[model samples]
Target: MLYGLSYIFTKQATAVASPLALLGWRFLLAFVVMSGLIVVGVIHVSFKGKRLRPLLLVALFDPVLYFIGETFGISHTTASESGVFLACIPVAALLASAWLLHKYPTRLQVIGILITLIGVIVTVLAAGASASLSLIGYLFLLLAVVTYALYSVYVDKASAYTGIEITYIMLTAGAVVFVTMALIEALEHGNPQALFSLPVKHPSFAVAVAYQGIGSSVLALFLSNFAIAQIGVNKTASFIGISTVVSIIAGVLLLGEAFSSAQLIGAAVIICGVYTANNTFHRQKRQSQIEKKSD
Candidate 1:
C-alpha cells in the first residue's frame, strides 16, 4: 500500500516541483528521520569489515537511479500506467537471477515470462495508439524496474553480510547522492536557491515529501524487511501484486486519471503474468529446498 501510494505522491509532487528536487528533499528527510532514530536508540546502526562497497552499490541502484527514473517516469506518464510497468519488476528480477545466478527457470516460469513480455507490448501499443502515453516515460519506468530488480538481488547479498543495518547505510548513501544531484541541477539551472525554495512553495509539496520520506521510504522499508524476516522473501514478495491494484485505484480516485479499456486489459494481463511468474519460481524453489533437506 505504501509503495502504491508513493507513485501517487510522486505524481502529485512532481506537478509542483521537479522530479530531481522532490527526490532530493525526500531522501534528505528520510536520512534525517532515520538518523534521529539511530541516535534515540530506536534503531541501532553498525557495520563491520569491508561491506561499504556493496552497500553503496545497492544505494546506487535504488534511491539514486530507481527514484530518478521513477519520479521522472511518473511525471511523464499516468500513475496507473507507471504502476503497471512497475509490476514488471518481478519478471525482471526473475530474468536477472537466471542470468546472474545461473539458476534456470522452470517451464512454467518461462511461459510466465513470455506472457509478461506480451502484456508489456500490448500495454505500450495500446497507450501509443491512444496517444496518451509517452515513449520516454515508459522507458524510464522500465529503467526504474530494472534498477530496482538489481537492488533486490544485490541487497539480499549485501544485507546478509552487513545485517539489517544495511538499510540505514543504503538510505544514507542514497541521500548523499540525491542531495548532490539536486545541487548540481540547481546550479545548472542558475537557480541555486531552487533546491530549498521549490519544496516550500506549497503545503501539498511538503506533505508529499513527508509522506514519501517517512511513510514510503523509512516505514515501508522497515516493514518490508520485517515481513521478509518473519515470512521469508518469497511469501513477502507475493504481496507486491496488491500494490498494482492500489496504485491504479488511487490514480483514478485521487488524481482523476482515466485509463482506456485496452490499457486496463493490458494492466490486468501484466498483473496476471507477474503473479504467475513470481509464484511459480517460489514454489519450485521451495520444493527444491525440501528435496535437498530430504536428501
Candidate 2:
C-alpha cells in the first residue's frame, strides 16, 4: 500500500520539486528516522564479515537506480502507463531468480505471469486516449523494474546473511546518492539552493516528502525485506501485482482519477493472477519440504 501510494505522492511532489530533489529529501528524512530507531534500540545495526559489497549493490540497485528511473519515468509518462510497466517487476524478479539462483518458475507460475501481464495491458489500454506513451519514459521505467528486481533478489540473500541491518545501510547509501543527485540537478537549474529550498516552498511538497520518507521508504522497505527473507523472492514478488490494484484505488480516492469498466475488470484479473501464483508457489514449496523431511 505504501509503495502504491508513493506514486501518487511522487507525482504531486514532483510538481513542486525536481525528482532528484524530492528523492534527496525523502531518503534523507528516512535515513534520519532509521538512525533514530537504531539509537533508541528499536532496531539494531550490524555489519559483519563479507556482506558490505552485496549490501552496497542492493542499495545501488534500489534507491539509486530504481528511484531515478521511477521518478523520472512518472514525470514523463502517464500514470497508467507507468503503472503498467511497474507491474512487470514481479515477472522480472521471477526471471532474475531463474538466472541468478537457478530456481526456474513452474508452469503454473509462468501462466500466472502471462495472465498478470495481460491484465495490466488491458487496464492501461482501458485508460483510453489519455494514456500517452513516451519511449524515454518507458525506458526509464523498465530500468526501474529490472534494478528493483535485482534488489529484491539480493536483499533477500543479504537479509538471510546479515539480517535487517542491511535496510539501514541501504537507506544511508541511498540518501547519499540522492543528495548528490539533488545538488547536481540544482546546479543544472542554475540555483544550487533549490536542493533544500524547494520542499519548504510548498506545503504539499513537504507532506509528500514526509509520507514518502517515513511510510514508503522506511516502513515499506523493511516490510518488503522481511517478506522476502521469510518467504523467498518469487512469493514476495507475486504480491507486487496487487500494487497495481492499490494504485488504481489510490488514484480514485486520493487523486480523483477515473477508471473505466475494462480497467476494473483488469484489476480483478490481476488479483486473481497474484492469488494463483502465490498459492501454487506455496503448495510446491510445502511438497518439497515434506519430501526432504521424509528423505
Candidate 3:
C-alpha cells in the first residue's frame, strides 16, 4: 500500500511541478537516502560482474524512461485513465514471457488479460463520455508500460547480482542521467525563480516530489529487491498486481478523487483477473518443479 500511495501522490505532485523536476528531486532524494543506508552498513551492498549490463538496462528502462513517461502521462491524462493503463503491466509481462521463452500462456492467463482490458474500458467510461484525453498522453503511458515490461524481463536475468546492489546501481545511474537532463532543462528554460525554487511554490508539491523520490522511487525499489530475493523474480512480480487496486483506493481516499460506478466495477474485475493470472503462474511453476523432481 505504501507503494500504491506513491502513485497517487505522484499524480498530485505533477499537477504543480514539471515531470522532469519531479524526477530530478525523486532520484536525488532516493539516491541520497540509499547512499546513507550503504554508508551506515544498514544494507549490505554488493554486485555481480556478469549482471552489471542487465542491471543498467533495467535502470534505463524502468526508472530513467518509465518514470519520465508516467509522470508526464499523468499530467496529460486523468488519474483514472492512468490507473487503467498501469493495470495492463502484469498482462504485458505475461505476453512478453510467452514471446521470449515460448512459455505457453494458460487459458486462464489469456482470459485474465482480456478481462483486465474490459476493466480498463470501464474505468475509461467512468472518466466520462466527454473527457478529453489526448493521444500523446496515452502514448506516454504506453511507453511506460513498454519500458517496464522490458525491465521486468531483464530483471530476471539480473539475478546474478543481489537486489540491493541492483537497486542502488540503477537508482544511482538513473539519478546521474536525470540530474544532467534537469541541469540542461533548467539552463535552456532559465526562469531563475523556477530553477531555484524550493519548498515555497507549494510545499505540498515539494512533499509530493520528495515522497515520490524517497518512497515510490527508492523504497519501492528496496522492497522489490528484498521480495525478489526472498521469492524468485516471477513470484515477486505477482505482487505488482496489487498496485492496481491500491492506486484506485488511494486516488479516492488520499487525493479526494471520486470513483464512478463503472470504475468500481472495473476495479472488481481487475481484482478477479489478477487472482487468475497470479494463480496461473503459480500452478505452472509448481508443475515445473514437480516434473524436475520426477526426472
Best by TM-score: 2
Superposed on all Cα atoms, model 3 deviates from the true structure by an RMSD in Å of 3.6
Instruction: Please identify which of the two predictions, 1 or 3, would achieve the higher lDDT against the true structure.
Output: 3
lDDT of 3 by residue, 130-225 (tens): 433779889999998888777777776677877778788878977897777777777788764674474477787778867877777777887776
The lDDT leader among the candidates is 2
Off by over 4 Å in 2: 76-80, 129-135, 159-163, 281-295
Ranking by lDDT, best first?
A: 2, 3, 1
* Per-residue alpha-carbon lDDT of candidate 2 for residues 56-163, written as tens digits (9 for 90 to 100): 888899878898898888878986788778878888999998898777777777777767877877887787635556899989999999999999878866754444
Provide the global lDDT of candidate 2 against the true structure: 0.82
TM-score of 2: 0.89
Residue pairs clashing, model 3: 26-213
Clashes of each: 0, 0, 1
Global lDDT scores for all candidate models:
0.71, 0.82, 0.73
In model 1, what lDDT does residue 218 have? Answer: 86
Indicate the residue-level lDDT of 174 in model 3. Answer: 75
Q: Residue 31's C-alpha lDDT in candidate 3? A: 91
Ordering by TM-score: 2, 3, 1
Candidate 1's C-alpha runs over 4 A off are 70-88, 113-145, 159-163, 223-242, 278-295
lDDT of 1 by residue, 203-277 (tens): 788889999999988888767655544543333444565565566668778888776687577667757765775
